[model samples]
Target: MFQETVQVLERLLRSPSQIAKHCAADEDPRALFLASLCATLLGAAAFGGVLATSRGGLQLLYSATKVPLALVITLVLVVPALHGLAASLGQPLRLSAVVSLVLAATGRAALVLLALSPVVWLALDRGIGYHSSVLLAAACYALAGLSALGLLWHGVGKSLRGAFVIACFGLVLVPTGAQTAWLLRPFIGRPAQARVPFLRHRESSFADAMYLSALSSQGIYRAPEPNSHPAPRGATNLADDAEEAP
Candidate 1:
């Protein structure tokens, strides 16, 4: 069995096109379409929960705003990773810094559009507190800008560009995962919230964690729920919500 597996692996790696074709056999176009739909529903649920209370909005605003902040934060975290990746791909170490910075700037611009536009629309539609809206708006813009930076880097950072792109995505995904964990922790019956530095306050209490999780009457939180409720006024919950291109 082991020898057979090794032989298959060797053959797969030798022909990239063959590997692609083989994997494509597992592709489910209909499932992908349905999954996309399901993703939209999930996002809407998350948005709806954020809209429930001013406190929740404030918390979400604080968190979502970190998207841009993460760009800067992750850049610091990701630079070394990107540098190494670039070098592996045959890029010059000497020029990596300039390339990384330029890419970051472009990503930031895209982030602003993704995060701020919906924030503005929501503030108008829901009559969110002005101070809250502005604060959220500013944070949203920051995220959009950073995402814009990432998109730029993805396109322009050539050698090890794939690695650079992966790193940027990691920068976005890491914080997102962290934030989701923070929000979900409280609702999962944890008794306390752990504070993370540099973004905003952590849940501070287990009960304070993701309110929507607690709010769910169903075992799981579904945006539209099976019963079907409207999503938040402005958020579609897509990456486009907070990670659009410039």
Candidate 2:
């Protein structure tokens, strides 16, 4: 019944006014089933892929309810698309085609989920903690896998393969982004080392001055500051200057 309904929906979405002319709005129960199934399968495949490959603190969340998350996305996105396909197929909602395809697609979705199962282990293998730099990969892979799964089930429906691949590419972006962010983090809080080039030179000099002044204050040197020159801005240098002068 669900499969039959989806076929009708596929026709309806493909060509809505035509379907409306012949079929009542509430005509098919199978349509709802197919819609729900597509949603479930695609959503599961999408999120499950992420759970399977992602490492880091977020892995826990991704892994825990990945299928359900996939299920939700399927309901929200995939089903509507299927409905659109049905509305335009130019045929009566055929039960056999609907059933066969839905079953095939759902089976593929399950396979994708299975394929995605390695994420947590893979992440841990890399020695990264969850919720750290690697979490984005997991999230991205999951989303990508769903699109891929949809394309696979639908047999190259409207750039599905490309879209899926693009989503997977999105995973690539996360790690690169994380590494870039990590590399650039020092500049954000930089205590001399991360300072801008010109600022780094000034900060380095200030650090050296501060270090010398501290040593002198601890009686580790004759003077951290020169008695002949005005004391530097650091408080430790002022003390050293007075001590050396007197």
Candidate 3:
């Protein structure tokens, strides 16, 4: 089982086409599914834990658990949309095939994240600022997302229609995945925060937070209004503190 799982992870990076083909046509996909799922869980958990190293403590566990949970939940929620988009784009696939393809793609992305974990840890250890670190993490996610999209593109046929299907699927995927991660925020707790929280109070959408972060990265900060209620003690603007620690 361990060897098979390792092979699945290798193929995900080295031979995405072979994985795509297996997902599409294998008579018995149980092995493939199990291997990919294991890869997804392990890879995401490792990356998540590394992300928490900046703030350290119980936050490590919180980020590790929440990251995989966010990815799995995002996968579950978006698979049906992917299926419908594929069919609408004139490339219908069996539901099981779609599931396998999506799982494999996610596993591929998770592996990319795992590969990036060390870099993230080293950057934090070197004393990168909080907002800069947030941008760095976003960049890592972009790379991992591209890896996942490559496999999905192959699964859908690597043509104009396939591109359309994947593009539409991405429209569903990016927002859903971001919001899911947003809801499960604080993967990297703030350095100044005294307590870790399992979840943060809802503030703004993921897009808004990211926008604020981008502006903040450019040295533009949103000043608090005099009449506005003060944010909670540990809570800081998404741009200023990124995600609060749990």
Pairs that collide, model 3 = 189-245, 196-246, 197-246
Worst 10 residues of 3 by lDDT: 224-233
- Candidate 3, residues 1-246, lDDT tens digits: the string is 778777777888999999999989956777778877887899889988998898899999999999888889988998899889998889999899999999999888888989999999999999987888888888888788888999999998999999989988888888888888888888988778899999876655677677778788788988533333244544345565354221
**Local distance difference test scores for all models:** 0.36, 0.37, 0.82
TM-score computed on alpha carbons, candidate 1: 0.35
Per-residue lDDT of candidate 2, residues 41-107 (tens digit) = 5544444434434322433333334444433333233433433444354322343333334333443
Give the lowest summed-lDDT range of ten residues in model 1. 237-246
Which residue runs of candidate 2 sit more than 4 Å off their true CA positions? 1-63, 89-107, 129-246
Model 1 segments more than 4 A misplaced: 1-53, 56-69, 93-103, 106-115, 118-246
Candidate with best TM-score: 3
**Relative to the unseen true structure, what is the Cα RMSD of model 3?**
2.8
Across 28-108, the per-residue lDDT of candidate 1 in tens digits comes to 223322322232233323332333233342445443444334333434554565455545655434344333333333233
lDDT of 2 at 73: 37
